[model samples]
Target: MSHPTADRARQLLDLHTQPEILVLPNVWDVVSAQVVAATPGVHALATASHSIASTFGYPDGERIPLDLHLDMVRRIVQAVSLPVSMDMESGYGHPGDTARRAIEIGVVGGNLEDGMRPLGEAVAAVQAVMDAGRAAGVDFVLNARTDAALRADPQAPRSSVIEEVITRGRAFLDAGAPVVFVPGLVARDEIQEVSDAFGPRKLTLISVPGASLPARELQALGVSRLSTGPFTQRVALTALQDAAAEIVAGGTLPAGTRPLN
Candidate 1:
């Protein structure tokens, strides 16, 4: 199998001819990465940080150490032939440390979020990370995430949500982030509004099972990219549970469920 090259990732980002948004199914491991890469038109692979952390018996909130996370990135990169982007939650440290380690492991892209930092400080962190990538000769696609909706109360005003995301997104872009990811955005009109507000700027929309609109529909609204973001991992876990329950209930294995070697 072919391995992902830096040039391939750069080419993927340079294509801005259409309103067609790239759908990136989040993968937790080498097997999932290979499965997603086998699907047609899946030009890139994105790592779900939550999924990765959970697999290692850790929670999603920066629980996994940086060395282990980079090791996982290296393994996934070796396993798949498509460009791999990682969900580098809060950069796992200060911006420079995270970005340097990410590029060192051959990750072509990653997401950094403005979690607890002030907006300006977050931008500066991201800028340091981008500089680290450039110094390593990797053209990293940094998709900065603004987590206002996830943190704020559900009853928060829509205007407050919009204002925070736009403010953070602008700073990230100015600091060299190629794309801005807004998680927890659900409504079609809201997605369109964000897309319109960031015209010519790349925007990444994340989908949760019931919280967000469908991926194809979001693409139609001009989103630059779509990610499942730990949803697929949950689906896999649910399936395993159901299968185990069936066995415990004296149900026989379905025919052709196992392959012959």
Candidate 2:
């Protein structure tokens, strides 16, 4: 019989190839995972490293210790039957080991950022994570990320940034990552350019506030996934802030509020 983790890994990979775009609302903890999983039409769950770190009072970029991060991830993995992919920011400088540990904790896939590292080094990091997954008998879905657009020079031409994203994205795909996540390029033309470069259902993008296109339009452009990275957490916090302000003004809690945890 196939292992459950391996099965889940395959399921996540398959989601990327389907005609519809896989939309993931990134989660931070067990409760968030449970809530998203319980929602109709959610096929998978992804963790936002930023959200997780902030919940623990730390900043993002892997500021939280690996063990603590893994512990929280384990709780989330156990909380839902859906495939869980972790945002392993730069792999804590040990891509292989980190991937292996995450796999052991039942995480079927992950996002590993290149952080604009040297091409060779970033390719090796992608390989390391995939190698770890292969050794563990799971077809890990590595959403290899390129920060080219995120770090692009404002004075540089937009075409140059698109080219950089395509270059890094192809390299990561060749390094065994099933999909390449290119964040920060929200314009329709830019997204279409990168999506065309990567071919059908192989490009993933982060959905931030004011994204130009809806999920269906992105799917029409051949983008495979649109994940809300840390935005969900921000939205939740905004609601809390609004409610707290109302309470201080002598208002009771919101009428429609109910228990989710």
- Best model number under TM-score: 2
Shift of residue 31 alpha carbon in model 2, Å: 0.6
TM-score for every candidate vs. truth?
A: 0.92, 0.98
Off by over 4 Å in 1: 1-4, 15-18, 254-261
Residue lDDT tens for model 1, 124-217: 8888878887787667788888887567677889878887777777778778888888887787877788788777537788778867777777
Deviation (Å) of 256 in candidate 1 = 6.4
lDDT by residue for model 2 over 1-261, one digit each (tens)? 999999999999999999999999999999989989999999999999999999999998888999999999999999899999999999999999999999999999999999999999999999999999999999999999999999999999998889999999999999899999988879988888898898888899888787547888899999999999999999999999999999999998899997996
Candidate 2 off by > 4 Å: none
Pick out the ten consecutive residues of candidate 2 with the lowest summed lDDT: 206-215
